[model samples]
Target: MVFEVIGPIFLLLALGYLSVRLNLLNKEQVGTIGGFVIKIALPALFFQSLSSKDLHQIWYPGYFFVYTSVTFLLFGIAYWLMSTHFKNTMSQSAVLSLGAGMSNTGLIGTAVLSLLIGQKAMTYTSLVVIIESVLLIPTVLILVQLGMQQKANVAEIVKKTAFTLFKNPLFAGVMLGIIFAIFQIRLPHQISHVLLMLGQTASPLALFAIGGGIVGMSLKYVNAQSFYLVFSSNLVMPLLVYLGLRYFTDVSQEMLHAGTIIASLPMPTIFAILGQAYGLNEKTLTPLLMSTILGFIVSGTLISIWWA
Candidate 1:
């Protein structure tokens, strides 16, 4: 059953890697696939997962409070290091923020936890995605932009920041799903079925895209210091957080596994996109790719053992 669950995910990643190797897809095409996963597939997954769970049955708000608190704290410390010690530009700081804290809560977290912890945990995973996609990304990006240029107009910054969450499909999906869940609206069976089919595509698709996207990166630029910084987030940070959760929090074994995996998820491809948009692509892309690819393998192994 576990292999049945994990098989398609690895298959899709293999397909994506193969697609890149065969020159069947270019960087832009791979990126479009990522956008599709975020916009269409992942949102469907969230809506389907969230809408099915009774709001009353889901876990406490305090769980999210703790989760968000931990995320932001880690991000804050990392950002300070990048900004002050590293003398990083705003965009680079933003990338570090993402690398340190943004977890793969939606695609990988959902599927893996469902297999290990049962379907009930999907709600928790979905909520994590909500926090990351809707709240964290925008907040961190605003800081990044500000760090890059501190003299920008406050009002303009507010306007652009407010629009950030709405512009992303994954965020849209999370908000819409939460709204429906909050209102206790029932979808028609046909609509739910359609969503189930589409939402099924998200996990493997994302993994595949990760594999292909790694092709765009050049490991040559990776330095000892950059490697260490990225490693802190991808490896050590998760281990520290996991140990803390194991001792301090009253979270489930499943949640512990989930939290660790989320912590260890590859630097979001969104970081790469943001970097490119801001012309910091070359500076940040290598570390992002190296950490992500290595993080995927390391974290996936850890999750497998922890869940097992």
Candidate 2:
């Protein structure tokens, strides 16, 4: 079962790596493809995933509340550790925190969950995406801006973050899907079909783009700090979630499993994009992402097996 789940994922990643190494695709083309996967395909997938579900049936506030809380808690801890122990600058620490806290749920989580747990799991995963995009992302961006000394005051930081987030297509997609689900609105068959077609491309393209992106980056910059952050993300966060849900909360078994698996996913691909936007050190962030992605395969499979 583990191989059945992980084999295809790594194969696509290997293909992406070879594509870049062999000059079949350059970095610029990979960037364009990655951007499309993020802005277009992912949003469509989020919309279709959420809109197709009955919100009342699948909406579990306890799950959302617990997962979001744990996510932010891990972010805060990571930021503190990097800032104090590693002596990283605040901006650097913020980016590292993001790497540790944010899971690649859009790509990795969706694919794994859909395969292991089925379509209902996608609805739960969408909720995770919404929390990350809506709350955690903006908070981290504000910290990044503050760390970079770009915004002078809290108000300015909040305003800029809000503006940027609203412009994000992924967030827009989730909101629209939630609205549709709440209203019980059924999209026209043609429109739904088009979205389905685009959405279908999200998982495979996203995985491939991740591989291509990794190949385009150099790993020479990896250091002890990078490994620490990767471990925090891939192992520590998920372990906490699994234990907490099992012992502390009344969340369903399915939700408990979903939370653990999603938490175990690698850093989101967008972390690199945000690092660039916020003037983070790419040398460090790139390796951190790459290592985390590679690490999650092992960690995720173990969690899946244990949870099963």
Candidate 3:
């Protein structure tokens, strides 16, 4: 069962890598497909996942609090170290922090959790997705923008951030889904089916796009900092989430496992994409690749122990 779950993920990743390597798809084409996953498929997935469940299933205050807190803790530490100690520019620091702080809850999380937990995976993912899309990702992007526009004031930044969040497809999907869940509103049968169809496309195409993006990337640039970020993201962050929930809270066995596994997952491809934006290519790429490879070990162990 574990092999059944893990094999297809790595296979899809390899297929993506091979597709780009064989010249079947260029990087730009991969980006266009990735954009579709983010703007269309992923959002649809989020909405369908949340709207179909009740608020009781969707809301786990202890899980959300611990996950959100650990996320902020990691993001804050990474940002501070990068800016003050590493002396990276604002954009670089912000994006780098994202590498340490964020996990691939959208693409990888959706795939793995769905397989592991059945439909309950969506409920687990919805919580993490809210934390990522609505909170962590927005905060990083805002800082990235603010870093670029040095003259921008606080009020202006806040206003623009609000507008940007409102327009963000991920945010919109999460919000709409939550609204429907809270109120127990049902979508029309046809509309729900349409969303499920689009949402279903998210995991595989998104994973393929991720593999294609790695075509020209190599691990030669890995350094001490790369290892540091990898350890922080792939090891320490999840460890903290696991310990916090296990000792301090009384979440379900399922929630505890889900939260830890989510944290243990590698940093998402978006981290490298954001880093690429600010010319921090090798900075973000090495740790991302390293963690993805390492994650097979980390998450696989957790599954063996808990799901055995």
Candidate 4:
């Protein structure tokens, strides 16, 4: 039964890698697939999913508090380690800290939770996306900008980051969906069906893109830092979220489970992008690869223990 949910996910990923390996799809074509998922399919999925949910059904104060607080706290810890212990440049530290603190919740988390828990997965997924879009990513950008540009203005950076998030296709879709849900405005059936069709393509394509991306990663980048990142992302962060919510909040059992599973997702593809742009290419790639493999293993085990 567990494999019924898990098997197809891995097979698609493997097939994607195999396609690239056999030259059936080159890296450029794989990148095109990723772009399609990020710019089009995911936005549609988030919009369609959240648009159908009531504000109350998706909004859980306790869940948000625990998730945001714990993730930010972990990010802080990673930042401190990089800046103090490793003595990396501020930009480098900020880039590495992203891997430690964040997850690929949009693509990987959404795929897994929707399959494991059914329709309500979208509600939890949107909630996490809100935290990431509104709070987490902006905070990372603020620090990264500060580090990269010594003369940068704090307020200006904050403002620009906020504007960027608002303009982001993913964020725009989510915010639009939330607005429609809050106001109970239903789109015409044809439009909604169009969105649903696009959304249904998101998961498979996302997983395939990830696998193809992994083929380009090299083993030379695997180091202690990679282990640290995978440990933090694939294990420590999720464990902390689960413990904090389990002992401290009145959130339901399923909510607790869902939150942990989301937390356990791998470092996002964006982490590697930011790293390469800022000159931490190998550092980001190794752990991004490691975390994906281990993240699935850990999340899969959690699901089996709870549901199987």
Question: For every candidate structure, what is the RMSD over all alpha carbons to the true structure, in angstroms?
Answer: 2.5, 2.3, 1.8, 1.2
Name the lDDT of candidate 3.
0.85
Tens-digit per-residue lDDT, 1-308, candidate 1: 44554566577778888899899998679888877877898788777777776676555565576677777777787778877887877667866666676666766666556656665656777767777876788787677667667596767776798787778777777677777778888788999889988887776677777778777568655775467557766876677667767777787776677777777766666666776777767656877877767776876687557544
Cα lDDT of model 3 by residue, 146-200, tens digit: 8888587868777777787789897788889999999999999899999999988
Top-lDDT structure, candidate number: 4
Question: Global lDDT of each model?
Answer: 0.72, 0.78, 0.85, 0.86
TM-score per prediction, in order, is 0.88, 0.90, 0.93, 0.96
Q: Candidate 4's error at 232, in angstroms?
A: 1.1
In model 1, residue pairs whose N, Cα or C atoms come closer than 3 Å (at least 3 residues apart or on different chains), thus clashing, are 90-148
- What lDDT does model 2 reach? 0.78
| lDDT (tens digit, per residue) of candidate 2 on 172-236 | 88888889899888888888889988987877777777788776466655777777767777788
lDDT (10s digit) by residue, model 4, range 211-243: 888887875677767788788888999999999
Indicate the worst ten consecutive residues by lDDT in candidate 3. 150-159
Candidate 2 least-lDDT 10 residues: 283-292
Off by over 4 Å in 2: 286-290, 303-308
Question: Which scores greater on TM-score, model 1 or model 3?
Answer: 3
Report the Cα lDDT for candidate 4: 0.86
